[model samples]
Target: MELRHLRYFVAVAAERSMSRAAEQLHLTQPSLSRQIRQLEQELGVVLFERTTTGTALTPGGAAFYHHARLLLRLAEASREAAHSAGEATREVVDLGIPPGLSPDWVVRLLGLLRDEVGRASVLITEANSAEQLRMVREGRLDLGLVHERPLQALTGTRLFSQPFGLAVRPDHPLAARTECTLRELHGLRILAHGREQVQAAHDALIVAAHERGVTPLWRFAQFSEHARSCAEATESDAVVLTENSARRLLPQWPWLRLAEDSVDLTTWLIWQPATRTVVTRVAEVISGLAEPVTVPR
Candidate 1:
C-alpha cells in the first residue's frame, strides 16, 4: 500500500534473503517480516516462499515485483523533476559512456553539450551497456552511449555503425594482411572485451568465428588496456576490436577488417522517453552529428 512497502519488497526480491534485505533497508529483521506479512495480508496473496537457502518469489510476487520496480522508478523521476524545476539557477546532466568507446565521439558529444546546454554541467560515468541501461531506467543517468539496443521500453537513436576488425602487433604474421578471414584466426590466442560488457558484439564475433571453424583461445577483459596488455604478454595473435577502437587504442598495430559479412558493430544513443529538456537537446545534437551508416556486414 505504501511506497516503503514496495521498496521493502523490491529489496527482498533483489537480495533473496530476509536478513540481507533488512540490513540493506536498515530495518530489523522482525520488523521487515512483519511489514511483508501485513502487505501479503492486504493483497490477499502469498508473496515469497520461505526456504532454508533464502526467499524465492511466488508467481504473484514475481508479477508484483515488476510493477513495484516501475512504480519506484516513476516516483524517483517525479522527485527529480520537481527538484530540477525548483532549481532554475543551474542544470546538471548525468551521462554514461561505455568502455573502449571512440575518443573522437566523446569529444564531439562534450563539445555539443557545452555549446547547446549553455551553463549546464555534465557528469560522466564509465559503465557497460547493461549497467548504463539500468542507470537510465532508474533515473540515475540522463543519457547513455551503448553498443546494443535496449530490451526495455526506452528510446534509442542509432548512431554510426562500426565495422569489426582484428588488431595485430607489427611482429605478428597477420599484421601484413590487408584483410583477414575468420577461418585464419584458428589456433591463435585472441583477446577481446568480455561478453558481459558488450554482449551483442561478443556474441556476433563468437558466431562468426564458429561458422568459420575457428575456435581461438579467447581471453576476455573489461578494459581495452587490459586486453592489449594480455595480448602482448601472452603473444596473442590478435585482439578483436572495432576499427575505431583499434585506430584510437592501438594505432601502431595493424588493424585488418574482418571478412565476415554477418557481423555488425553499432552504437546507440539511449535515454528514457521522458528525459528532461536539456537531455533531449543533448541527444538531438548527437543525432545530428552522423547519419546511420549501413555497413556491408
Candidate 2:
C-alpha cells in the first residue's frame, strides 16, 4: 500500500527470495515477511507463491509487478524533478534506446556524451522503438534513440538511418551469397525485431513472397538480443538488422555475415517540444553527439 511496500515487493519479485530481498533491503526476514503480508492484505490478493524453491508471482502477482515497476520509476522521476534545481547546474542526461542499436553503440555514445558535456550522469533505458518514443513524448525521458523514422505526431531531430540487411552466420549456406532478395528468401527462416510498425514490416516481407507464401520462421527477441542470439545460435537462417548494427556485431563475432541487399532503418532523436529547459539541454547534447552518424543508403 505504501511506497516502501511497493519497493519491498519489487525487491522480492526480482530476487525471488524473501531472505535475499530482506538482506538487500537491510531488513530482517521477519520484518520483510510482515511487510509482504500487510501488502497482500491491502491488495486482497496473494502477490507471490511461496515455496521451498523460492517465491514466484502468481498470475495476479505478475500483473501487479508491472505496475509496481512503473510506480517505482515514477517515484524516481519525482525525486529527480524535486531536486531539479540543484542538479540543473550539473550536466546529466537520461537516454532511452530502442532495439537494433548495439550495446557497444550505447557504450561509445555514453563516453562521447560524457567527454563532450563533462560531469554528466548518463542513464540508459532499453525498450522497443514505439515504447521508447512514447517515453520521450510523455516527458519521462530527456531524449530517445529509436530504430525508425520520426512519427508525424511527434517533433524530433534526425540522428541517422542505416540500411537494413539480412544477417546470417558465416558458416550458413546463405553466407556465401553476395546479395539476397526478399522474394528469394521464400521458405527460408528469418528473425525480426520491434512491435507494431516493425512487426508489420516483417509481416509484409513474409506476405510479399512471390508464390507459395512461405512463412519465415520467427524467433521474437528484444533490442539487439534477437539478432545476436539468432546469429550466434544459427537458429533462424537470417535476421533483419541495420548496417551499423551488423557491422558493430561482425567485427567481434566474425561469424555473423550480412547479405549484400539491405533495407533502410532510420534512427532518430525524439523529444517533446514542451519539455523543460534542463531536459531540452540534455536533448540538445544528445542531438549534437549524434550529428556525425552517417545515414546508410
Candidate 3:
C-alpha cells in the first residue's frame, strides 16, 4: 500500500475523529473517510467503528496503529539518511530534557523536529537539571532544558517554570486537599528530588520553609531513569513533584498543588556558544512551546 494510506490511518487513529483528522490533514471529511475505507478494503479488515463519544479503533486497527507509527518513523529516518549522501557526515542533534518535563511536550517536540530538521536526526535523553547543565557544558549535549540559569559554561534562555505539587498517598491526610501550604507539611516527611538533580530547587524549598518558619522532615533522592522514585516516595507523607511529572510517573496517587508565596523554580533552555544549525532550530521549536502552565485539580 502507498505511504499516504498509512499516514491517513495514523492521523485518524490519533485524533479518533475523521473530521478532526481531515481538518489537520487539510482535506475534506468525505475525502479522508474515502481514503480510510480504501485502505481497510485493501487490508480486508474493519479498522474503525463509530462510538457514542467518537470513533473507536477495532482490534485490527489497534494492532495496526503501533506498527504504522513505527513504519512512518522509519520512513522519515530513511529520507534523512538519503539526504545526507553529499555531506561528509550526517548531522545528529542530542537534546536533554529534565525529568519533570511533560511527556505531551516531548511527543510534540519529536513531531516538530521531524518536520523542521531537514537532514538531521534528533535524539532525546532524560536528565535532571544539574545533569543537563553539566552535559551541556561538557559538550555531551547540544541542547538542554534545565531548572536553573547556567553561568559562563553555557548560555541560557528563560523558557518556563512549573510549580511544585504533592503526590500524597490515598491514606495521607493531605490527599483530598485541592491545594496545600508549607505550614500544613510541618512534622511530615516530605519526599523531594536531591541536590544532584536540582540543587536550586532543593535550596528554594529550604528557603521557603525558613521564610514561613515551617519545617517538614525532608527526604530526598536522585530519581533514576524510571518511575521507581514514585514507588519509593509512597512510604513518605507526600512526594513533591510537578503536575506533569506526577501525572507521567504515578498517576494513581493523589496530586495537589504546593502553593508557596515566594518560592521560584524556573526552567532555562541551555546551549553553548556557536551551536549547530540543527541544534538551534530544534531549540527554537522547544522555545516556541514554552509558556507558563498550571495544573487544575
Give all candidates' CA lDDT scores: 0.83, 0.70, 0.80
Every model's TM-score: 0.65, 0.55, 0.65
Clashes by residue pair, model 3: none
Error of model 3, residue 74, in angstroms: 21
Alpha-carbon RMSD to native, per candidate: 12.1, 10.0, 13.0
The order of the candidates by lDDT, greatest first, is 1, 3, 2
Instruction: Indicate the residue-level lDDT of 128 in model 1.
Output: 86
Off by over 4 Å in 2: 1-91, 169-171, 194-223, 226-235, 243-261, 289-297
Clashing pairs in 2: 164-263
Candidate 2 structure quality by residue, lDDT tens digits, 1-297: 799999999999999999999999999999999999999999999999978899999999999999999999999999988887675466556778875565666777777766766666778887767778778777777778776566776668777655556666676776776566665566666666635636544544445543445455655555454456555564677767655666665543222323433444557888776766666766776676554445423
How many clashes show up in model 3? Answer: 0
True lDDT of residue 192, candidate 3 = 82
Per-residue lDDT, model 3, residue 158, is 79
Per-residue error for 265 in candidate 2, Å, reads 1.5
Query: Candidate 2 overall Cα lDDT vs. reference?
Result: 0.70
Q: What tens-digit string does per-residue lDDT give for candidate 3 at 1-297?
A: 889999999999999999999999999999999999999999999999999988989999999899999999999999987987767664888988877666776777788777877566878888887778879888999998888878876777777777887878777778878788888989888788788777887888888887888888888777744544644644577777777777767677788887654355678888997888778877787677666754222
